[model samples]
Target: MTDRSHITLYSGGHKGAESEFGQLAEQWGIQEVNFSFDGHTSIQRTRGMKVLDPEELDKGNVSMEIVSARMGRKFAHANKIRKVIQSIFHMVNNGYHVLAVGWIQPDDTVKGGTGWGVELAKLFNRPVHVYDQERNGWFTWKDNAWTAEVPELDRDTFVGTGTRNLTAEGKQAIHDFFTRAFGPA
Candidate 1:
């Protein structure tokens, strides 16, 4: 028998996708690692989450406010984003096939970061399955099946198999690809 390959699933704190992914992980016995910076703690603090300090999350945010802070803020944000992307890339490079599951919304800030996950998957030659918010009819196909509309990060990458929900076919594809790369479920 071959080894069961490990899959490193990249995720964020988006409640909806997080919950869905957490459920799937529970069902499948898959492990997940989430990457995040200070803002998460600050948001939680302001909202009175008692798990950790309220001030920790504000470090990056406060550094963004230093005098003549425009450039600092931009670089700080860019650096954080770069770190997050790098973390994802490192996980893939370390030989675990990745499953990047998270939110992709219409807002520009959120959308830009969503693309990073796609780019990371492409960089590692892995498949990225993006789950979007809107339940639109556009993703529906004549196959009488619906899927999430997944877009490519660049031209050289595998344009994802868009399925609104993770259909049995989609799951089979994932299972097959990973099994080929690693081994059986």
Candidate 2:
């Protein structure tokens, strides 16, 4: 009766390792949902703009489109929370079963990227699998801790797991996992 299906990958857009990881997820049944702020504009547009228009607060689609343009150099940080919420809702409403969040290290800045995925996992009650080269970590009352117990992802650089190193076997594993979690697609 339950039509559990589809896995979504939320990463720091499709660039560098993040982009590569998205491709790997595609190999599996997991669909990479590019929540990148860059989808709205071209690189040329992001050149010198400083701040996003306040009016964009109400017009997300238009604001986001402008943000995507490279002319402003507008980072995806300012409205990431809203963006993730929108992205999650959009995907889930459309029938995605699980979400695979991609993350990188150096989690201290304003828009630390992985934090969005982790937050979304908690928000959606989905189990989060984080793959990073700097050891696996989990939040705690005092501080987060790292260990070897976390699941190792395929090494597509983006996957950043010890076991899942972007190999054919690793890619297959991701596909199987997504299928099991989200159902067919």
Candidate 3:
């Protein structure tokens, strides 16, 4: 078996996929880092939580207009969402592989801030995988398109982010993914 202890899961520690991923990582004896900031209160995973200061968060800052243009959606609360968008940057920047569970919009972006993380992964040319709940399958970004495939966590560090509304199927997929990568925990 692979030494899962060496693996580190970077995430936002949200209620849905990130929490599930963190739980699985703990079960598998893998390391986990859940990034957060001041005044943010929805975090579920406390282990390895690295709260970022204002300056640290600024390093990941980008114009909200650019984010809106890229995601094809407008943010009603730009100020509130800015911190989240910035925090996602640290997760994607620290991880080599990105695995997310969300709805992949027709616009080729995974919905919400999770999409921002996915976009960064693509920009960095890191391997990105998304398990679309609606599609009920995993799709990996390959050659400028999302192709169907069963992905393995070959890297020592990876980011896991997705929607807060976790589904039964989504949870199973995360479990199966961990099992496929590290065997029964």
Top TM-score model: 3
**Per-model TM-score on C-alpha atoms:** 0.39, 0.38, 0.97
Can you list the residue pairs that collide in candidate 3? Answer: none
**Structure candidate 1, residue pairs in collision:** 38-57, 147-163, 147-164, 148-163, 148-164
Ranking by TM-score: 3, 1, 2
Residue 99 CA displacement from its true place in model 2, Å: 7.1
Clashes of each: 5, 21, 0
Ten residues in sequence with the least summed lDDT for candidate 1: 42-51
lDDT of 1 by residue, 18-103 (tens): 33443343344444444344444311111111222334333313222331132222444654554434433333443233343333
- Candidate 3, residues 5-78, lDDT tens digits: the string is 88899999999999999999999999999999999999999999999999999999999999998889999999
**Model 1 CA lDDT for position 102:** 32
Q: Per-residue lDDT tens digits of candidate 2, residues 71-165? A: 22345565654553344333323322222322333532112433433443334544345433333332211124323233432322222112212
Model 2 CA lDDT for position 61 = 33
Query: How much is 31 displaced in model 1, in angstroms?
Result: 2.5
- The order of the candidates by lDDT, greatest first, is 3, 2, 1
